[model samples]
Target: MPNLPLTLGCWDYDRVQALMDGRVRPEGIDLTFLNMVVEETFFRMLRNREFDVSEMSMSSYLVSLTKPDRPFVAIPVFPSRFFRHSCIYVNADAGIDSPADLVGKRFGCPEYQMTAPVWIRGILSDHYGVPVDGPTYVTGGEEEPNRQEKVPLDLPPNFRVERIGPTDTLAQMLADGRIDAFHTARKPSTYDGVRVKRLFPDYVEVEKAYWRDTGIFPIMHVVAIRREVYEANRWIAMNLFQAFREAQRLTYEGLKETAALKGMLPWFNAHVEETFDTMGDDFWPYGVEPNRATLDTFLRYHHEQGLSPHKLSVDDMFAPETLEEFVI
Candidate 1:
């Protein structure tokens, strides 16, 4: 029997390098790995259902479920995760000395529903006591202009989402103090230390403390399959999941080969060791079971921020094929 032909749209990550280079093919799928930045991939996938499978914004994927047009179902393959403490940039003159000061300020993000901002907003509210509904959210492009949300949202009236003018980009707005704070995945070009600064300049220590206090390593993206494709070919889910897992396994093994230092970092192995000490062996775990707390927290954030109609469980977001693996 011939293998199913599928295309996966995702960013160029070390974990999925094997898949892109044709070294680790899915068990029975001919995967054409479409390499692109996440924004393009997400915009295309959400707008047109462009690929058979793709890295989707986790927050947006949750919102998709509430829409009657249930376009996609995801496996528990997370291609991107980040500690979002460094993602918050604020105008130097905005008088936002701390998170609490951010209340009543104009906060800008690329989209009200993007995953990075969702994580940033949640973290600030939960840890810093800056209410989630406090900031008047300004939404538009970060570098370009007039960027729109991937999915249409029907948020509650209390949520204040105001759009920037067609020509206004959040990057420029933050520099000009038109928006007091900017939270997005990519750092804006205006992030000069003097004009635009991170809310926590010492974000490394702060993020470490955050992890120590709360075991939440924020997740940004998940690999999702178009519902039409998934419904017709259910077995493809596990095949792809196992393939992604194997690819990550290779990357993890590569991260430890300190014989000559595989990466550019001089003390790469030291950092890896420190990471292992802080997080466990399988630090960057990909599965519903290990990530239940993280996913559940994100679901709560999605619901609280009004991006999701209701809080969804781990089972609600992932394909059942990825929930467990057979023991040898």
Candidate 2:
């Protein structure tokens, strides 16, 4: 067996390790798992060059798309519910009530430009009639100076914004009463002397409604491979995708067991279970034929938001030949 170097980035490192160890063999491929993030960081310090391997991290993956050189055979992992962002938590001591009470309250977030914050602000502006535009709304990120950007013009004018550090800081801020409320992507188990009152559930609900209304699903993330890598080692790429598919299938069937084994914190476990229950069926089929509806929805949003230089066709995002193989 030729040892293959595969890098995986996820919150549940142990679960992935178990899968690779054949404790939970999905597709019979036992590729070696490399600690890419830690290794890459260390190598970069010594040689000032990045360690080259297939890198996978949901957060970093989006930034990867903006790179001109993209991979060709990245496989889409399981689809998680869209509600993974923009939760509203309040200090247990604080008497903050509904979304309307957010006025004059300080909030913390992971990033202002992140999808969750943007979506949450949009919902508050469009649905709840929150005035996000003025000085009353305060949000901050970890980055220095805590930059704030105007909500998209299409969104409500009153959407105030700020940046905060990571989710933990946000939780802490809420707990310490430094912020009356904080908005972040929190699992159900997150507790920092504060309690999550309401997350923007409407984010997922609205996404589903949009899909039903327009047959378009929001694109949260993508699995991309560099074109060059695909040409050189198509077999490995295909095998990798098969492994991912099998893993996803196993995850779906063994949800409860996987959750326990993954040692997901209580809040995360419930959140994962709920998400799987809701979006499990919509997970893309393993074979080629990418979910046209989902991709189209994502592209449409990307185009409308001017995020992409040009609208990408289905072929632009997926390899047609690989997809054809999966078609019945």
Candidate 3:
């Protein structure tokens, strides 16, 4: 049989290149990998008709698998870990001590629609019962190009939000005490000067907290294959899974080395290493079966908050047969 052409896409160029170069091997599956950011990969896959490889977000991949027109099987990219959304940083001069102090304060964020904002609002609403409706909210960019559309939450009638430009500007505003608090989707280590605090430390204690609490892990990103190509060349999908699994394992085991050699931006490198370390053990298999409990919880949370338009079931998000083959 002739070797089929396979395209494996990823955002982290160093990690993907390491895997392809044989310096890191997850589970022995070799692939022709293509490195790209998650958004770019998704758009490319969606636009291409002839491509057989799958392109998807981790969340969407599972959702698609459960759909009747399941485009491609889901695969595990890495282990699960507590992923904290936007870090809430208050300038020392702001005099805001806790969640309650956020009222009437000017808050800076990357955006109201991004994942960090969603998680932050959810935490505040579900835990503190603070009304986000009345606070002044500031977005980072004046205009976000190709921003991912998110479902809006019920902001308190008293809440006000405005769009500021760039993360640096937002941070500077916080530093100058212009904004009372800034919510960033970036990990805590990414920022300095201001004291960064997790919004819901108790609930999101570890990476698996989402899985344990809601049984539905938020789909971060996924490899999506075109439908026709998936049907015609099933092996490519399977092979890709094997390759990723191997890559993930190698990446985890060599986390320290990978960190050292990659020489990423100091904050980003630290955050990536910490994340990999936390998820090294509970990683999912590179196949379609998602952590049902995690998905269920996420859907329930989103649905209750009116974040998700439709209530989706486990079967509505993943393929049973594909999942069965990859469960670790």
Candidate 4:
């Protein structure tokens, strides 16, 4: 009997590197891992279903569920998580001194449905009183010109979203004060601090305080298998899930090693300690039950913002096999 062949597309993270290097192979599977940055992987996967398994934006996945013939089914493995406070950038001339000041200003994003912006908008609306529909949204390329939304959106009538010209870039638009603030996952090169600065200069402390208050570590990306692939081989869901979990466990072990530093940061250990102190040992958690609140909150945001028709439950987003485990 031959092992089933599969291909996975995702970013090159230390956590999932074990799988990339062939060290954490799933049982009864022959895996081919394609390591790329998130943007390309996401664009390809959403546009074409390029890989058998791929990294998907949580917001986009929710949007997909709204479609009658959705393309993918996800496991609980979140390869990427981020604090989006640092993702908000504002022009110096926009009179936006704080998050609250941005109401009625021209807010820009690469796309309204991008995961980071959804989390950012929801957090700002919930915490800072920045109304979700307060600003007129300008969407287009951030660095390059003419970028389009990977997934199409049919937002509510109240929300105002418009696109920039084919030759226009949001980085230039932001620098020119045409757009007051920008919410994005990738920081544009035009951000000189004097011109375009982060909305939260003290974002680290602010994010820590947010975590302390809310206990929600925002999940940025999830791993998904194409629906056809998943349907044909349902067992692959748990096999891949367990493989990813092992890879993440290896990552934690490597990060906690005291013998020598893994990367350039001298205070990596201190940062790790601070994370544990703040969020506990298993800070980056997987599975449905442990992440219910965060997932539910995101779903609520997705629905309210008109990306999802209804708020999807945590159980609705993940594979059933990954939802439970057998105990001794």
Candidate 5:
């Protein structure tokens, strides 16, 4: 008989397609997959512990560690990794031509403690000497009028974060020049106009330089198991970890299969080759040891940005079962 059944919540990204289709399955366990938008999934999972397993925001997960009754433990399976250089947008007329100019400026954010913004701000401060608290941050939805921070923050006195009313939004304020810039995980709908432009005109080049220097790809989301579920079934950690790795392996194979262009791009194959050359063969590695630098870097940023009440190490983040993988 099967050991038990579990519900797993995540986006239907290409990386997890095999698992979603039942082509890959964890040993001794059955999974009920919940395909949902990342925003809704994260909100529900973090706020209510609504799923047995789910993908969670790295920033929010760190903050959750501060609570006396932590509800979840994460595996090192990153479902989403993105560089945030392209997330920062500035008003064309704001005189913010470079990262250094962002100091003392007014910036809008959907949430100051979101993973993308945390990585962007940390990079800005560490790489360009911009103070992490340099800008006065206004928080609200990117397009909609009503939004709020998912969790409370414990910031230093110099850090200024103001929550906006239901009638206000970051995109509208940015277009109207009420804010000098806005940073978000997704592009604002107002981005089609001339009023707002990406802070880095050549963001690709900028991002490449950053990666070359730091070797950090910046993990946005990680897979987590409900604490009670994990405690009741400790062996499930490795089973789920191996299943995710197999799913990712299938994704890599699909990307390289050149019988026809797997994606819509004309240069899909060439792009894959170039990426391998630039980022190395195992670009999207999943294990804890392979991702230690990135995990450590993000943890440091979370602590320094006051998102985490105290500094937490990488070991504090992942399950002990996930800390090592068996070698052949």
Candidate 6:
């Protein structure tokens, strides 16, 4: 049989650019790449199984594991990783000087179960002594209206979450004093002025310290294949995983070739060198073993926050083929 053609959905990130441009081809597969906004890709995949393979929110993926019928299975190819400390924005007039000050305040999130907010919530509770249930949570769209949670959540009674009406975005709520702070993966539109500022002004320093302490560069998304597809073509998982790793390798090489600086930043090379110094040679790693710490912490957060019905081990998230590779 010929290599099966598959639709792969993801954001147009540099790491996945090579795959989309046909520079990196998965063995025994004809991939048709669909580059779109991450939210669109995730929503479509989860709600409708819109693609043969797609990028999915890690938190959402964990929660899906608890369901009776999960439509997708993931590989360890993490397309998006970020530090959530900088995702938090607080109103200047809210008297929130630190994560500790967030207690007893009203805070907004794009979604409570979204990957970024889950990481932010975990950081606040673990590092800064801010309890997850301490603040009232307002859930709504960050920039647009009429956004809804991708999965159904059975939050505990102690957790307080209020869904906003269609007229309001979380950004407007934070700026108008309806909420004291907001957390969104993307900067809220209201942050264009002084109305909103990050709770941690020196987030870069704080995030670096956090990484040094925890060795977790919070994973936001994992690449998943439709369950039906994976059942029929199990080898495709390893093939895709290897192809993604190759693409990531290309991205890292691009970051180091500053002789003719590919990006516009003047201090790009200095930053790249510092990143390798701080994060080690493999800055954005792809395999399951290398990212076990981050995976464990994220799963714990998901279960504790009522996003997942049970605590999921790292082994439950990926294909059996991904757990081992043939040595050449």
Give the TM-scores of the predictions, in the order they appear. 0.98, 0.56, 0.61, 0.98, 0.98, 0.98
What's the TM for model 1?
Answer: 0.98
Against the true structure, what is every candidate's RMSD?
A: 0.8, 7.4, 6.7, 0.9, 1.1, 1.1
The Cα error of candidate 5 at residue 285, in Å, is 0.9
User: What TM-score would you give candidate 2 relative to the actual structure?
Assistant: 0.56
> Which candidate has the highest lDDT of all?
1
| Reference-based lDDT, residue 36, model 2 | 41
For candidate 6, the lDDT comes to: 0.90
Cα error, candidate 4, residue 237 (Å) = 0.3
- Compared to the true structure, candidate 5 yields what TM-score? 0.98
Off by over 4 Å in 5: none
Per-residue lDDT of model 3, residues 181-284, tens digit only = 77755543324544534433453464355445544344444456666665775555555666666666665555556426445466756766665565555454
Question: Hey, what RMSD does candidate 4 come out at?
Answer: 0.9
State each model's CA lDDT, in order.
0.93, 0.46, 0.53, 0.92, 0.90, 0.90
C-alpha displacement of 117 in model 4, angstroms? 0.3
Encode model 1's per-residue lDDT on 1-328: one tens digit a residue.
Answer: 9989999999999999999998899998999999999999999999999899999999889889988978999999999999999999999999999999999999999999999999998998899998899999999989999899999999999889999999889999999999999999998999999999999999999999998998878899999999999999999999999999999999999998878787888899999889989988898999998899999999999999998777888897888988988899
Error in Å for residue 159 of model 5: 1.2
lDDT for model 3 comes to: 0.53
* Candidate 3 residue runs with Cα over 4 Å from true position: 13-19, 22-30, 37-82, 93-95, 103-107, 111-113, 130-137, 140-169, 176-179, 187-191, 194-219, 231-235, 252-280, 283-290, 304-306, 326-328
